[model samples]
Target: MSGGGPSRRVRADAERSTARILEAAEDVLAADPNAPLERIADAAGVARATVHRRFSSRTALLDALAAQLNERYVRALAETRVTTAPPLVALQRLTETVFNLKLSHRFAVQLDAAVTPEVLAGLDLLFARLRDAGVITALDPVWCRRVYLALLHEAHDLPADSPVLTALSAGSEVEARINLLVDTVIGALGGTDTTNGLLVRSVRTSASDDRT
Candidate 1:
């Protein structure tokens, strides 16, 4: 029984260490995909041996990061309640979630293994629903999806101190930028009617959460 306590603590520490390494890998690789494991270990504030113990090689580490991003993507969708929420609310939540996801894990999104086709199809279906609801004026849902993704990619690339980010006085600079990105996407999709009110309410809830 005494041994179990120490074993559990060891496991917990290992888990924490692994998580740190993965986060550091995301940050480092996002900047330089060819960065060495030593660089990641330095970023994680862990020894090279520790990173090697968890990930046998750089490729393995990358694979793990991609998997972690996929998990986060799935979790983000669930948190948005995409299937049950009103179409406009769901679109705003989805856009924000995806924008933040790409912003946080840039390298993973670039990888081919990150998001599976099935997940993307569901997102496309969401766009189609918006079209059916008269929220998106685009005749082609595929075109709307492409435009939305393009805008997200552009928004994620904006520097933290950019004027676009600076103009919004909201919960945080990033939050403000994301909200603006959502609005831009909505506008580009021609959701310029009552959907604007729905989007505002959705963003207000998100901003409130950030304040708390």
Candidate 2:
């Protein structure tokens, strides 16, 4: 038992190192998918050997990170309690959670685009709820949903240090930022009176979609 403290410390440090590597991978890979492992190591403040010890190859690292991200996104949904909240509150909470998820881990956003049918079903419920509440516009649900996904993907193009993102990260009024985007979307959608018959649809994910 005398050696246990040192061992525990070593283990904790290793875990911290691994976490840093994964975070660095997300940030670096999000900007340039082809960024070298050396960049990630530098970002993590760890030796390249440490990263290699945790993930033998770049692909292996991404795959593991994807799994980690999926778990986190699921957790965020649960923590946000979106479904149980009131319509505006639920939308606000979901927007905050999703934008934060994307901001923190771009790779996770890429991985999540390969969404399962169950997730699409959840979106369907959310869209219907918002429709019932007359919050969303009267546009085609499928079209609206596609726009929503597009917005998420497109936002990644913003520089990591963009003033908009800086304010988003530091803002005391979280809803204000989300409201800007949401208001733009709602304005684009117009009124429910203009709604077409097009209902929500499934999200198809080709295996190669993540490569982009």
Candidate 3:
């Protein structure tokens, strides 16, 4: 069916206001999930009434954020080139990307409340695609999804003073740890061997340096 159209100016203003409102809402909620609508409206430089008009209620705003996060997830996954890498490597990269993104965005704290079952169920479809594409192991997609979520959740919670965080902030440590974790999980699933070659290499290298 053909849709009725608003004028270009009206649409543009709406688009701008919506973007501003979402950005402000994200900031406010990230700081405190229970922040009131008036505060969000203030942050957005809009009136409280306008905020309500734009988003009928707190639930509506949260729902919008959840939708925005899923959109980001889809975009990140699409941009990731997993076809050429081994399944484990691809999974590691994907998890690292997700973790890094979450660390930069405080909205991650609201994930538990904002992400509805329907949204998560939709994510299963993406997991299925990855599995079918052989970009991930043939384990239960649900389990894989949970693992991916756990990695992001843990990364978000990692203390700022942690050596892991320091290493990750410096370079590829986050990726390295994620790879190690994936390998461990995959090995436990009997999909591969747990040789711990990387750890062994690190230890051997450290001993050699000490002797030097």
Candidate 4:
């Protein structure tokens, strides 16, 4: 007798299709946050009914997206050596890794996902490690973490054709982005800036900036 191989194969295929839909949703929503579900299904090369079968509703779709992201976030934090790595190194690694996670999910392109308490608790634990390691002091560790994440989203959320985004797309882009972010972090922490560090210009904006 067969070990129900066909049923197992069909289940695996369904799982992969669901994953494909989620990934496409992320890319599509990143570009057009209000993109329709039909667009996402088109991007994934799946039928609209398949999207419905998998996600049921926008809320369900978003839930799946957030769940996938939570897994990635937990895995990322586990890999980052906040307590052992050098301050700047840890900062760079964590910022890049976390920002990449934001990019990797449909539900959090703006880093506005419905963060669960477990995730926030995990962040607090990481910040405590940084404080104990003397990587950061004076500044509240929670605030420091927020600043890093804000810097990441602000810089990366720019339009694809934005000059800042274009320049950052050149060689060693992640390194360049990390340098600017780390410099901002160091400055905010009242630490001395490194010699030969990137000198990012201060940005100024007001209500009018949003009207542009």
Candidate 5:
């Protein structure tokens, strides 16, 4: 007469194994976009049988990966210390974090194609928070999520040798690009001027300092 639940330790171990699998999958997929489950299992130091037992199929694995990514995004949004930051600043941070994660974890490629309805629901929850916080304008949450996904897809497609990606690998250029893009998008939504004076000024200052 047991309750319908696994023991706590068993549950914990299962969760831990799942996390490891997801981490390994992200690494393998980043290196090779079409990484197989056996390869992911090998990278995670687990058996192929175990990987199949856990994920059941490629689609299941991708669905789990999408859930994991959305969970990470939600956690980042919760922990971000943006109480006093302007809407644009918060949006910039959110976009940069998402872009970086997508670039680093190739699981993002599958997100757009195989994301489950549950994952979209989770994203809607996060988007509600962003909307409540005024981080984005009052647009349809579904549309906003689609737009975010599109931007991430574009960022993920950037070649590793591209100047933007190179700068992202090197320093704060990714953050700068996120800020520029966010400001531009927000300005368009708000019907305001989108020419960013601060960026132009910073570029000029850097050039002037270089000459000295």
Candidate 6:
């Protein structure tokens, strides 16, 4: 005589526990890839048995971590308007959003997760559009995508104490790095910096027009 579903409160508690465990795992494992579940549970403020209940094994936890990050990446693409915005604007915004994600999950990103081709399908389409529009050089979209991703990984590998970060206050450090990343990506893919200048002008004009 019961609806065959868990109570709403039970579902809410499960969701919170899962989120906490994932966040803690990302931080703990990043600091020590060899970190045990006990440590992660401590970081998450949960019982050690709870971690096991949530993820059957280390491998399972790692897979979940990868899946969570992929979901976040897809969300990032949508939130940044990658599919619908102007190519230049979309590319820059996507790059900025991904830069933060990669850095935030630096260790988890290095794991050999089963990331599907569909996870990157949106980016591939965007790159093709940019190439066709002459926004980028005559390189193949696939190559461009590879170059862009490699650059992002390199940026993620940069140490927190690197001179580039150390030279600026915390508030400005991320901005400076992202600016450098965007410029370098455009240059590497045979796009001109002048287009960026144009993008800036267009954005300002669009904002002004919107207010009228």
TM-score of model number 2:
0.64
- For 1-212, candidate 6 gives per-residue lDDT tens digits of 66846687788898899899999999999999999999999999999998999999999999999988888877887876666766766776777677787778866788656245765787887888888778878467778888878887776567767875455332455655555555667777887753323443443355345436
- lDDT, candidates in the order shown: 0.77, 0.62, 0.62, 0.65, 0.62, 0.74
User: lDDT of candidate 6 vs native?
Assistant: 0.74
TM-score of 3: 0.67
lDDT of 1 by residue, 26-72 (tens): 89988898899999999999999999999998789878988888888
- What is the TM-score of each predicted model, taking all chains together? 0.75, 0.64, 0.67, 0.75, 0.63, 0.81
Error of 2 at 85 (Å): 0.7
Candidate 2 lDDT at 2 equals 78
- What is the lDDT, from 0 to 100, of the residue 33 in candidate 3? 78
Model 5 TM-score is: 0.63
Instruction: After superposing candidate 2 on the true structure, give the runs of residues whose Cα lies further than 4 Å from its correct spot.
Output: 1-10, 112-121, 134-144, 154-177, 187-212
Which of 2 and 5 is ahead in TM-score?
2
Q: Residues 1-212, candidate 5: write the lDDT tens digits.
A: 76845687788888888889988988888778788899999999888998999999988988888777766666656544234333334444556666676666665546664355655665555555557666456567687667666665565565556664443322455654554455445443332333543433343354345436
lDDT of 4 by residue, 1-212 (tens): 87999999999999999989988998888888789899999999999999999988987887788777777776666666544544345455666777666556635644446466666665666666656666456447677667766776665564556555445423455545555566656666555543234322111122123225
The C-alpha local distance difference test score for the whole of candidate 5 amounts to: 0.62
Pairs with backbone N, CA or C atoms under 3 Å apart (clashes), candidate 3: none
Kindly report which residue stretches of model 5 are placed more than 4 angstroms away from their true locations once superposed: 1-7, 80-86, 113-152, 155-171, 190-193, 196-212
Clashing pairs in 2: none
In model 5, the clashing pairs are none
Model 4 residue 77 CA deviation (Å) reads: 0.6
Summing lDDT over every window of 10 consecutive residues in candidate 5, give the lowest-scoring window.
80-89
Off by over 4 Å in 6: 1-6, 159-171, 194-212
CA displacement after TM-score superposition, residue 52 of candidate 1 (Å): 2.5
